[model samples]
Target: MVQSASIQLENPQEWDLSDLYQSFDDPRLMQDLEALQQTAANFRDNYRGKVKDLSAEQVLDCLQQLEAISQQAGFLYAFPALIFAADTRNAEAKQMQDKVMEAVTGIENQLLFFDLELKSLDDQKFAELESASVLQPYQHYLYNIAKFRPYKLSEEVEQTRNQDSLTGRQAFINLRSLHLGEQEYDPVTTPDGKTCSTEAELSALLFHPDRDVRYEAYQSVRKVMQQHNSLYAYILNTVAQDHKLENQMRGYESTLQKQLLADEVSEPVFRAIMDGTKSRFDLWQRYYTLKGKALGQKIRTCDVYAPWGNDPVPPLSYQQGVDTLLAALSQFDVNYARRAEEFFLKNWVDAKVRPGKRGGAFCWYAHGKHSYLLLSYTEDYNSLFTLAHEMGHGLHFAWIGDRQSYFNSNPPMVLAEIASTFNELLLLDYLLKQAEDNPQLKQALITRQLEDQLNLLFRQSTVSRLELAIHDRVTQGSFDQSFVNEQWQSLYQDLCGEAVEVLPEHQVDWARIGHIYFKPFYCYQYTASNIVSLACYQKYREVGKDFIPGYMELLAAGGSLDQVKALRQYVDVDLENPATIAAALKYVEGLLDQLQATL
Candidate 1:
């Protein structure tokens, strides 16, 4: 039954994309594309085969030109992408996104030879070039290319793969987007006979205090996935197989090596996170058991997000949410809060819950420009945290844009997640302090924090494990619907243990994970970054104001320095150590103790 909880409603909230471009018909869009194509052609004509022979000053000139071209291309793509994300059902936006992608690919094909030539540079020549003072500015960029030397193919073959991706991997990715965008599920009927239509609306119900509503919403959404399981399975198989074939051709020994190479994370560190998460599955189980005790009912998969205590979640308006978030940031640093306010003032966030908008929240960094955030806000407590999380990403990119060039602005996913998750911890701290005198509210806030950790740490690793199993299965033979379902169920069940019932519908839940299809092996980074964020947050708690300088510097460093070095230098956290992961779990255990005392 729908409880008497009143949802906070306000004026319609939307963002302005005029900063990206006036509209799809904007002449600057086409002019930029044309300019990009010509620049790439001129660049290729100048530097295609001369990378090894160029002087250090000449190499610097080439890189600067390439950086300018890359930035413009990124701007072109961001316009349509932000549009499509705002309303995936917009036909014009879809067409524009597709058109921009093809054009960008052509530009990339033209510029491919420059990188291939750099990769082809022999060790002595590469070292000699690196020693030159003129090339010092791009030392990391030069080193990055050098590491991929073994993976470089002939220019002809590389160009062919680049062009084919339009119809190959990218096509499958697009199909998934369009499928989810255009496909509507059966309406979820609330106890009051109110019917909710879009996936975002259905997802909002999963947090309802009423058990029946959550289960119905869960079943309604999964049933649709079950009906289209075959197509999803095919899409997953095709994309994974393409990844596998490409990895094999690129001389990578395993599917994950390519990502690790890009992420700068070592194999031991990856295993430490995954293995540590599995070893501590009791943390997950214990949390669910605690949840059941607090709710005074048995926990189920559908009730994972249910509110605790007697009171339903209070109605938090969008502006109220922003105020709370900014207050939290202001307590941390006025500069941080000031930067975040610009996002709201500039109309850079799309927070309305509308049909066909993407389900999850993401902050898209527009390279040289400011960041844009997108999310379907349900005007609830959880929505507030989602806002803070993405705002963390926005602030991180803002710092990067102020300090780093285009070549150095892209932080690895692991590092990128720290800034975002740290913001979440800050918000949690602020909320818990406000609820200090109210034991039930404290317990509720603590439960939310714990559950988010479980999702970020354990659940993400489970997703990672399922991804690995599926990729392995594809290598052995093509997998059908049953195989994918069983893998997800087995991994998920292991994580759940006996604490929560895994409904039959939960077996097809893998299809709902866009990351698996969009970027395989991407979920584990959440777990990895959670550890670092916790450590950073822990330091902030202990040192108070003293921790601000290094932390701010860490954010400002962006991708210019090595991530491991950056963490160690600024935050004094080491990613390679098993102790870091153990410290994070121990902190989680402390939260469990607090929750138990409240009960």
Candidate 2:
């Protein structure tokens, strides 16, 4: 697959990692490792048992050293990860990724006493550090780690888990990638006589103007999934078991507790999202009903993405995609456009879907360094928006680099999404404005944009619901594919209600989702992010450019502030408020109304 993508004038499509390491075997990669190991050993020698007696000044010195070590370790590990993401088939990339993760874990194991003993500090000393002006930056970091104090294990046990990780959760994830990467969906000829084989190829056909093309590609993918569902089911079960076992050992109250803690979100926030999103199934049901009428037939799963009224939009080229994205960005903030220019000029993006590259798009950020975007671009509206979404992540990382140190540069997964989705919304608004003279074009564009938001919010929430339910059941015992399919279809019934029908073959979708298999309880952040971003966008409508500085402040704050507290102080959106979710749903409805007028 990996298309011919040159972005624009003299733009490169492959990343230049010389900035990180010259190549996979660069001598500096190992040198960085040796230095990191020495730093860890020396730090342990200096502070292993001395944590209890350290003054506030000494604590500041210890924090600085820890940050330096963590920063360098992050850079070393990020190198191979970025490489493997661009080309999963690269043997050397895979070796280096695994090697770095294993080595970094060893370094971290030596430094475990820093956090453990810090948390064990007497109440007075902990409070003194919390109030010290010099220690203000580390206050939130210190407070967050304190939450894990209850879950902390003996140093030996913690080290064992670190070493075991390569062969445990991460090992299963890698194996699943290897198994799924080479899968071949049968080739289906399009209505225009072009042939295709890859999943990305088949998926593109699913949105073709011709129904025959869409269904042929759809049925072909279903046949392929049927062949692999059992293996996927087994992989999921094994990983879920490991997850449950670890949570139990750590004394976590629930499967989702740690994830919520990591994001600094409360159970109430999650509950509000679930309640708010599920309550609006009627919105999706109505949209599907309208879509079915637009197609002049029943709305099956395959027909959902199909274009209506036979007005096939012209395809965009890679160069055209770049131009459209930057133009839209410039409309909101030329500064963003300026930052985005580097993605093309510096080869910061790997956009073509070559053989065995990871299946989806992500912006991998290296702390204190730059970010690289791995995307599968096909020169369509969806692909264009994907470029914007990931570039949002790239932009966020770049904007935060100079403002926050390495440890604080990464925002929570929830706030991490604000930049990406907000970028998508800006492009959507720009496209909507351009099509205003032609109602037909306007309707189509609005429907497309709303559908993307709906997918991000509603469908992503359903994904998390399925994970929660599956994990609950797995804790009871292992389940077969039939059981897994039933759980998936039941959730479909919940989301679609009595109106929409999910194909039996599509029931195995639970197998194909990569997030749950790799990072359990992760998908809900998409739902949460969309809700929060839309709320932030609502603010933008009130004050325009006046909102940009405050928004920029949140991104720069990163993990330096509490996730919800940052939202409250900077953007004035309270995540725990159910009304926030309702506001996002109302936004969806307004778009649906616009689409209805065209119908």
Top candidate when judged by TM-score against the true structure = 1
Please, what is the TM-score per model?
A: 0.97, 0.95
Worst 10 residues of 1 by lDDT: 1-10
Best by lDDT: 1
Question: Candidate 1, residues 1-599: lDDT per residue as tens digits?
Answer: 11112323264268898977999889999998998899899998877777889988888888889889988898999999999998889999999999999999999999998888888888988898888998876788877888899998998899899988999998998898888888777887877687888888788888887788888888888988998999999999999899889988899877788888998899999999999989999999999998888778888888899988666667677877887788888889888888888787778889987888877889998888989999887777788889999999999999999988888898888899998999999888888898879876777788899999989889999999998898888778788889999989888899999999888889999898999988878999999999999999999989999999999899988888889999999999999999999999999999889878767
User: Candidate 2, overall lDDT?
Assistant: 0.82
**Per-residue lDDT tens digits of candidate 2, residues 499-597?**
566777679777768898877778889999999999999899789999988998888888899988999999999888888888999999998897788
Count clashing residue pairs per candidate. 0, 1
- By summed lDDT, the worst window of 10 consecutive residues in model 2 runs over 1-10
